[model samples]
Target: MNITVVGTGYVGLVTGIAFAEVGHEVICLDVDEIKVAKLRQGNTPIYEPGLESYLIRNIEANRLAFTTVPTQAFAEADVIFIAVGTPERKDGSADLSYIEAACRTVAEEIRHSTVVVIKSTVPVGTNECLETMMNTISLHSIHVVSVPEFLREGQALSDTFQADRIVIGAQDAHSSELVRSIYEPFERPIFLTDRRSAELIKYGANAFLATKISFINEIANLCDELGANVDDVASGMGMDQRIGRSFLRAGIGYGGSCFPKDTKALVQIAGDVTHDFKLLKSVIEVNNTQRHRLVAMAKAHFGSLIGLRVAVLGLSFKPNTDDMREAASLVIIDELLESGAHVVAYDPVAQSQAKRILSPTVEYANSVTEAIDQADACLLVTEWDEIVDTPVDVYCKLMKNPVLFDGRNCYSLDEVKQSTLTYYSIGRNDIIHAYT
Candidate 1:
């Protein structure tokens, strides 16, 4: 199959590369000339694990290509995937301008019958509207199928190859079958449903996952008040077969391109239908407040952040990807700096990307030791391997005050109990240094 994937962002790039890896000829289309040039030179613009290697190998085998010209890529393609970003608007709705433009281009450029697969996360009824628009504009008949991607960052390749189930949503059986055939190479269960249900599936899954994180964080907060350990609580709860644990870890809260945007968009989707989503609204509120909890913990310890030097570890939302969108570190660092603290931050791979959004006043450190050296307190934001594997005693040796705030619960209470540093973590008892 000749596949043309529009918008070479995370979803687009991964989709195109994965298809090409499965013996399909794929052309990844992006409007950015520089990005296209970089892809052509076997360079990936993003930092997803195992993506660059597979991209390079597929390109070498002539199975994958990249282009900025939409007409050339779409002309003879059998499947066109709209994998553009659906960023959340101020009102919490998904901004579909990019999807509209991509569909318009596909409608105008395609020369024959093509199955248009929407891999981008959009609001419900988007595919039906797109099909109407494509049929109206195109000379040939177009079949628009909703095939929302479920790949996770840092593990995109594994998720693609080993997906639990594939959902193919189309109005017509022919379109559904055609899309299903494309995934025949991967022996995964395929679910066929209407476009509306499929669209809601993606949003619903993210919202529920976000809810789980918020629920655990709330539980962790209560545990903190009761002097109970969240780790043991989560472990005991996870033993139940009905409630298998995945997003049960209590942290600074969920962040990334998906949960924050999708949860808000789903809330707005409910509003459009005149349904008030109060539970989801509270979930969003809890997540927002959870990010600030670490900052408050720091302030309580120091009495005043003024003239203090704070060390921050991990700037990315999560480890293995250099994405800083909605990262807890951003809010924590901003609050720390506003209180007149000198901030030094470190991440294994995200420092460069972090510099773009973070204040120029904050200093960047190359290593954990450098970031924590002579700092008044240290905050572990992202649980990157480098930060997690560092010796607990290093905090005692490096920081001026030796106070550590573990937002991700990277260290165990037993380990912190043996250390001389004052330790604070979510949903756990604070380990105060004897001298502090």
Candidate 2:
């Protein structure tokens, strides 16, 4: 199967490479010639584990190729994937400029009776709009299909190969068959539906996940106020078969490319139809508020953070990826600096991107221990492995007041009990303020 994937972003590159790995001939297209050149030379623009190696292997094996010319790539391809970016607009709607542009390009470029699949996350009715646009543009039959990707950043490769399910949406049975054939190698259960449902499914999934994070964060706050341990509360609730355990961990809220934008877009879309999605609206509100929860907690610990040296452990939204799109660490860093606290941060892979965003305003530490040593207090914003495993006593020996605020609850109360320092975390109420 010869597949042409447009837009060499995270989704496009990952999707293209994964297909090529499974013995499909793939030509990855990008408008940016520089990016195409870099990808051709085996230089991945993003930091996804196993992606670079996989891309290199496929490229070396002649299964995967990169180019800026979509028409040239799409000429021989049976499946053309529109994996472009649909960045969020200021009004909280998904800006479909890239999607429109990609569809137009595919419509004009496609020579065969091709299936143009939308792999990008778009609002409902987007696939229908593309199908109409393509029909108007081409004399030959071009079927537009909505095939939304559910790939997580760090585990994208594994997720794509072993996807829980594949959603294939098309207007007619012919287009749907072509879409399924393209994904036949995946061996996953395929959910065949109308285009609108497929589009809504992507948004719905992200919004629900975001809502869960917000709900737990709200619970974490309540625990903090009522002197209850959120960890136990979460555990107790998760034991129920209904809740089961993913995305229930209360932390500094979700901050990634998908959740923040998708939740906002869904809320705006609902408002357009005069439907008030109050729950989703609150989900966004709760997540935005949760970002600053650590800041408020920090302020409470030290009356005025002015001139205080604060250490921020972890800079990425979540661990295992170097994407800082909507990372909570950015909010925490800004708040700390705003309150006149000097912020030192560390992340294994995201430090370079963090440096670009954070710049000289905050100090970038070489390692987790380096960030925490001699700081007035430390906040574990993102629960990275290195930060979680750091010795709590190290801060006890180095800082004037060894205080630890566990935003992700990376440390147990018992672990911090032995140290001659202050420990505050979400939900566990047993460890009261030993000092003050």
Using all chains and alpha carbons, the TM-scores for the candidates as numbered come to: 0.98, 0.97
Misplaced by over 4 Å in model 2 are 434-436
The window of 10 residues in a row where model 2 has the poorest summed lDDT is 427-436
Over all chains combined, what TM-score does candidate 2 have?
0.97
* Per-model CA lDDT versus the true structure: 0.91, 0.87
Native-referenced Cα lDDT, model 1:
0.91
lDDT top scorer: 1
- Candidate 1 lDDT by residue in tens digits, 139-238: 9999899999998888898999999899989999998888898899888889999999999999999999899899999999988888787888888898
* Candidate 2 per-residue C-alpha lDDT over 290-351 given as tens digits, one digit per residue, 9 for 90 to 100: 88877787788788999999999888888899899999888888888889999989899998
lDDT of 2 at 400: 68
Q: Would you give me the overall lDDT of model 2?
A: 0.87
Number of the top-ranking candidate, with TM-score as the measure: 1
- The TM-score measured for candidate 1 stands at 0.98
